[model samples]
Target: MLFVIHALDKPGALGARLAHYDAHKAFLSDTSALKVEIVMSGPLVADEASTMIGSLFVVEAADLATVERFNAADPFRAAGIWERIAITGFIRRQG
Candidate 1:
């Protein structure tokens, strides 16, 4: 199944987001044990398209539990970057 993870950054969280950006990328790079495969992901930008305000990800996993595990371990989650996060099952019909 596929899941969509939409996370909005906490106000004034850019600094923390930047500080842990590398670790976040590294964590996403490897999902062997978690059994999750990232289908698409990127930062959500602000008006100017230069300031990142959040992050979005569409991933494939065996079940919601697997995706939940993957999300729970993200470095961004630990750094308190996201103020709100919504994870939902996705039904992709078109690109």
Candidate 2:
């Protein structure tokens, strides 16, 4: 099944997020089950187009457990960048 992992960074954790970004990207590149389609994250901009405050990723996994495992191993989690993580099963439809 495919899953979408939505993560919100802890308050004032931008430094942590930046510090772990390389590791996080490496993890994503090395993972087998996780296929990152779109990664959109940065500080939250006062305007809609400002910096990112969190991140959103579209991933594919076999099950919720797998997704959970992936989340647990993410560098953001290790660096305390994410305060909240929300995962949901996804169905993609092309019109």
Candidate 3:
């Protein structure tokens, strides 16, 4: 199944996000243990396109539970960078 993870950072979490960026990249580079494939992912930037406000990921997994587990292990999540997160199953009708 495919899932979309939309995570919004806290009001002032830019610093934390930057701090854990390397770890996050490393984790994304290797998700074999989690058994999930990152189909697509990127930061959600502000209107000016210079400030990151959140993160968005499209991932393929066995189930929602697995996707949730994958998300739970993210460095950003552990560092309390996200203020809110929503994970939903996706149909993927088009590109």
Candidate 4:
């Protein structure tokens, strides 16, 4: 199954995001993490601007539990950058 992860960072938390960016990237790019089969993943901007506010990811997993486990280990979570996160089953139809 596929899942969509949308995470919103806390207001005014850009500093934390920037501080842990490299680590977060490393975690997301790790072979173990990518085993879930990521289709697309990247930071979300505020409003067509360079300011990022969160992250979005489309990935394939066995179930929600598997995705949850992966999320629990993400460096971004460890850095406490995500204020709210939503995960749901996904059906992709376009690029």
Could you say which candidate leads in TM-score?
Answer: 3
| TM-score-sorted candidate list, best first | 3, 1, 4, 2
TM-score of each: 0.97, 0.80, 0.98, 0.91
- Assess the local accuracy of residue 33 in candidate 1 as a C-alpha lDDT between 0 and 100: 80
TM-score: model 1 vs. ground truth: 0.97
Name the candidate, 2 or 3, with the larger lDDT value: 3
RMSD of each candidate relative to the true structure: 0.7, 3.1, 0.6, 1.5
Best of the two (1, 2) by lDDT: 1
Better of 1 and 4 by lDDT: 1
- Write candidate 1's Cα lDDT for 18-86 as tens digits: 999999999988888899999999999999999999999999999999998999999999888999999
For model 3, give the 10-residue run with minimal summed lDDT: 23-32
- Tens digits of lDDT, candidate 4, 1-95: 98999999999989999999998887877636445777789999988778999999988888898888888888888888999999999887877
Best by lDDT: 3
Better of 1 and 3 by lDDT: 3
